[model samples]
Target: MRLAETVTFGGSDLDRCAAERKDAATLARNLAEGGQVIVLWRGKPLVAGDPAKGACRLVRLGAEDPILRDAEEGAIFLGRIEGQAIFAMDISGWTPPEPVDEAQIGAFLDPTVQLHPGAPEGSAFRELRAIMTTLTARDAELAATARALGNWHLSHGFCSRCGVASAMTEGGWQRLCPDCGAHHFPRTDPVVIMLITRGERVLLGRSPGWPEGMFSLLAGFVEPGETIEAAVRREVFEETAVRVGRVDYLANQPWPFPASLMIGCRGEAISEEIAIDPAEIEAARWVTRSELLQVFAGEHPEIRPARRGAIAHFLLENWLADRLD
Candidate 1:
């Protein structure tokens, strides 16, 4: 796991200026003084330029741009990159001149060439998952942060303590409820995605709705008051009826399909028997290292490898190469 952070969406060590988030004067000055902003529309990021050249461009606008006027809430500070202030704003209500391509709007597990439409003149609203592997570390992290924060704001407009609508505050980092005096921050659901290994094989499962032949490391959300290790063990048992022991931390990835932090781990499976819970997964099986190599090589007929940018793929790839240290 030494190279774990080198995974996609993992290496950008962006300086998230947490203390300055609440400072109105600093944020205003930053915005007015050459601060660049990333635009999010309905959770998708604005990308322009060619992805083949490692320039899957993240559309950035200045504070004076007219589009900033249409932002639904205050810009959320996304920290600075080499002294340049970065922020994210929501423009979900803006009307596009063209219609989005319906055929290109579904879930794609593998990276495919895409042509997006229905965006502003120069940019296209691209699904981050599709192009995550092609983006630079900086761009990937920024897009993930923007999408996660924006999705949280969209879903948590009301206070859970009272049935009162909350107002965006703290530079869009927090919401304030007028009636209940309750303050809410953005939430990131923690999920444990473990690489379960029993001797020479690893266990993988396919969800009910996934594309044919696609399988990935077993994962589940961490329940309330549960530790990461406990969650990993419980999730493995619940989904495939496989008892896991000796769980060890591997790495993590920011999965922004509505804001999740995937904690990757390696586990020792004590019980090889699998009784897949149909409600949780469609099927489960064990694959040897040679079989996994075939899957990655596109030679396996029964299983497609995990999505490229996902932590599951990262873990499995490293494990197969005997580099999961």
Candidate 2:
């Protein structure tokens, strides 16, 4: 695999059985014959261990598990692993035993965990960001797939072309509008996250409402009629007024926080000066290579490295090691 493909949520090559999704008979056979099942709540995947500590992984359940009774809209076929058909279900309908921290549910990285009374021992629905790094490549891919697909179904129940409810077809891969014959597939918003470098320093910015000391590579959604290269330069300049000369694609990650594909890129910034747009970002600054090392080592007094398991952190680490090739 290429070094770029090693980024979290990228390397896994699970076999997504597209043809079988159309075969309802085959899908039923797989589930009846014991396919691997994954359960999700809201956007969180059911994980087995505490991610804050060591040794955490996604929890896979059997098809006949009682908790499947609470699954919303039945099962979603989430491709295959080796020879086993993997399926997922969003049991958002399942309520918890007690009250939950509503504030944390929508935070950037929700630290809160919810335990379902019907789930397996030690299994709880935890935020994917909170436990992404701890999951194996296959588990991470499955979790991301389940979260992205489930969320898409939640918001896109109605057809865009006609004002009518669309039914999920092709084993949850598509939504067909019964009224207008409009077929809508899952949506993955394309985003550009570029590492803008000027000499030995890298440009970093923090959003207005982000926690103190949290900074990452400048990113923005790719606008219509925009190429990846153009989007990279535009986002960097718009946020920091730093002009970028040459841009190259590096890696890509599937960020399932409301479904986005983060396209990682590296840009050579021609301007050293930073002019932050308050509306775009709260602060923008350049951090030296040496200072970045301190930030990663937790020795920097005022700066925090990008969150682990994110493409930004992966790109920065590779850059620091001189391995962005």
Candidate 3:
């Protein structure tokens, strides 16, 4: 797609300096010299006041602060945001004690804060790419990593191998069980979202809990020992009773909403007979190009486009622009 990277958290040209991992001293020095600082208090992101008025944009720090001390671990280099030294913190496996003192925290969240309640109303959170560029791009990515990893720690505190509590190790990347010494790492489940097309119509479905009129591309988690191609075919056929052929990968996005890597693909539907698995999808249908255009423009009262910043939206927008070949 021509605008694939334009998706939220999609288009970042940050210099992820991987070589600096071995040199802790050098990395710390570099971070200190960097201009913008992205802070996370506890697990939730600390937005500077709020984003509605846009008062707390990234700014040059006059001096060092307590948050930057030893805050780096499982933290990777995100790109520069407006000449400020923007950095992300990976606080996985570490939960903050209760009684959050609002005054002592920096913004802590993946780039998806705008979608949640209490964040400013009537604001856009789906265009992560747009919001990312407006703030610290690299810092946003790093914060996302931290949030994802931290969530994993919260859920996977007990070792699956021996059913014992695990401890954070390897700089927040791996968890070690004190009883069995089992090492666990954060997970990124692969999900395939395909824009299945048969001539002029494309396949779309609405899950049981989705908002009214909201539909998205057919998707499913890739099972163990399954290729992306096989997963797409199985998912489409199982969900909508459509036989898929000629699957082609389009793009990928790191969705850290609890940790997922969305794999976008284009598939050809060999059969069009719609017989949805009533348990999985509430409704499934074929949408023509013109109908999709109306939905995108909010002219169609019966259908709502997929959430922005998602791979489904990326595929749909590209399909509209004639770039999804």
lDDT of 1 at 73: 83
Candidates by lDDT, descending order: 2, 1, 3
lDDT of 1 by residue, 1-325 (tens): 7797888888586898888888988998998899999988777788886666756878898877776676778888999888889999988777665665545555553232333343346567667877788788989999999999999999998999997999988877899999989999998899999999999999999998688889999999999999999999999999999999899999998888878999999999999999999999999999999999999999998999998889999999999888988
TM-score for candidate 1, please give it. 0.92
Q: How well is each residue in 1-325 modelled by candidate 3, as lDDT tens digits?
A: 5666665556355654445444645545656675344444334444433444533232222126443343533333333444433444532223343443343332222244322232233322222232333445444555566556666766787999999988766434568899998888779999998989999999999998676889999988999999999999999999989999899988887776658888999999999999999888899999999999999999997999987656788889888888865
Badly placed stretches (over 4 Å) of model 2 are: none
| Comparing 1 and 2 on lDDT, the stronger one | 2
Ranked by TM-score, the better of candidates 1 and 2 is 2
Off by over 4 Å in 3: 1-3, 11-44, 48-140
Rate residue 187 of model 2 by lDDT. Answer: 88
**lDDT of all the models against the reference?**
0.86, 0.89, 0.66
Provide the TM-score for each candidate, comma-separated. 0.92, 0.97, 0.73
Q: Ten residues in a row with the worst lDDT in model 1?
A: 109-118
Candidate with better TM-score, 1 vs 3: 1
CA shift of 277, model 1, Å:
0.7
lDDT assessment of candidate 1: 0.86
